[model samples]
Target: MNINLTLIGQSITFLAFVWFCWRFVWPPLLGVMQEREQKIASGLEEAERASKDLELARRKAAEQLKEAKEQAAEIIDGANKRANQIIEEAKNAAEAEGDRLKAAAKAEIEQEVNRAKEQLRSRVATLAVAGAEKILSVNIDAQAHDDLIEKLAAEL
Candidate 1:
């Protein structure tokens, strides 16, 4: 065989192989690479969106926590005020009860004093009648002198 003819045949075969690869195999490979690149870009965008959503959730949770703390403070303040009001009411009720008891005791003491005074007046009238009968040397008829005895007892 001629060396030049063999070299030319080899060169033509190499060219045909290169063209086939470019038309068929290379197109599919390039398509796969572009599809992978697009998928990676979309995944990066989704990750960025998820990060923003997480930040927003954190802010909302912080706001809710602040509102809850404020509501708790308000509830505590209201409870304290109500406790103070109840204490004042109890104190007033106790004072009123004490005053009523004192008044009742004073009235009872006055009634006892009046009863003693009445008993003493009756005893004094009886003693005077006995003395007058002994001095006059006669038994005094108390029933007959009922009006006089009653008048003298009233004066005593």
Candidate 2:
């Protein structure tokens, strides 16, 4: 082969191949590359949005938990106050019962003392009548002296 002719034929074939690839293949490849880049950017944006949502959820849950703890403390305080009120009412009732019992016992003791005094007076009156009859040496009229005996007993 002649060197100059071979060189010219190879150069012409390389230029034609470059032109065909540009017209038929380059536009679609560029479109596919741009589509892939857009998809990757959209995926990154979605991941960032998910991370922010998770953080917000954690904060809200913490707030709810704190509110629940406060409510439990208030319930405990209410129960303690109720228990104290019940104890105070019970103490008052016991004290009232004790005072009532003491009064009843005092009244019973007073009645017993009065009955004993009445028995002693009757006995003393009988003894005085027997002595008077013995000193006079005569039988006394018992029915007639009933009032006098009672008067002497009262004085004694």
Candidate 3:
């Protein structure tokens, strides 16, 4: 091809090309690329922060689990001690009550036996006097009957 080289035409073409690139291509394209790069950088930073937060949460959970285990052990120990104390106190109280009941029953039985013996003695004395009177066909004197009752009571 034959060369067509002119300074003015070359300068005009270069100016038009530069104008087109500045107006239609360079501004929006460079702006979009820069915005995309900034967004990627922000996303990477957010991911790193989230990872740190997760580690912190895991550590806090481990501490809470340990504290909970200690509290549970203390509660169980306290319950066991309280149960033992209650059992001991109950046993002592039951023994005391049994002893008191046993003593009361023994006293009542002794009193009842004494009362029965007294009643039987009185009845036997009355029957013996009645038989003696029937056999003799005579009424006994009051003073003699009283003396006989006294003797029988003393012997019993």
Candidate 4:
């Protein structure tokens, strides 16, 4: 073929190839690229939203942990207070019981001392009366003895 003829055919073929690309290849390729770009943008937005939600969940968990610690401290404090109160009450009751026992023992000791004193007085009085009767027995007539005995009995 001649150089000029070959050049003409090449020009026609290039034009036809460009026309085919514009009509069929370029439109679908551009559409697919746009769709891929939209998908990537939506994915990035979803990831940002998920990150925010995760941050919120972490904050809530931290708050719950703080609340749990406070509650545990409150419970421990309450138990300690109750135990102290119970111990104080027990001490008071023990003191009261000791006082009552001491009072009762003192009363019993006093009663025993009084009883012993009464018995000694009765024994001494009986001995004195018998000694006076023996000493005065020979000096008295019958009527006088009777009168003296009546007097002594009255004195006793």
TM-score top scorer: 3
lDDT of each: 0.88, 0.83, 0.88, 0.85
Clashes by residue pair, model 3 = none
Q: Which residues of candidate 2, in runs, are more than 4 Å off?
A: 1-28, 111-156
Candidate 1 residue spans exceeding 4 A from truth? 1-15, 130-156
lDDT of 4 by residue, 33-90 (tens): 9999999999999999999999999999999999999999999999999999999999
Per-residue alpha-carbon lDDT of candidate 1 for residues 49-116, written as tens digits (9 for 90 to 100): 99999999999999999999999999999999999999999999999999999999999989988888
Which 10 successive residues of model 4 have the least lDDT summed? 131-140
Candidate 4: list runs displaced more than 4 Å.
1-24, 120-156
Clashing pairs in 1: none
Estimate the lDDT of model 2: 0.83
What lDDT tens digits, residue by residue, belong to model 3 across residues 59-90?
99999999999999999999999999999999
lDDT of 3 at 87: 99
Two-way lDDT contest, 1 vs 4, winner: 1
Locate the minimum summed-lDDT window of 10 residues in model 3.
127-136
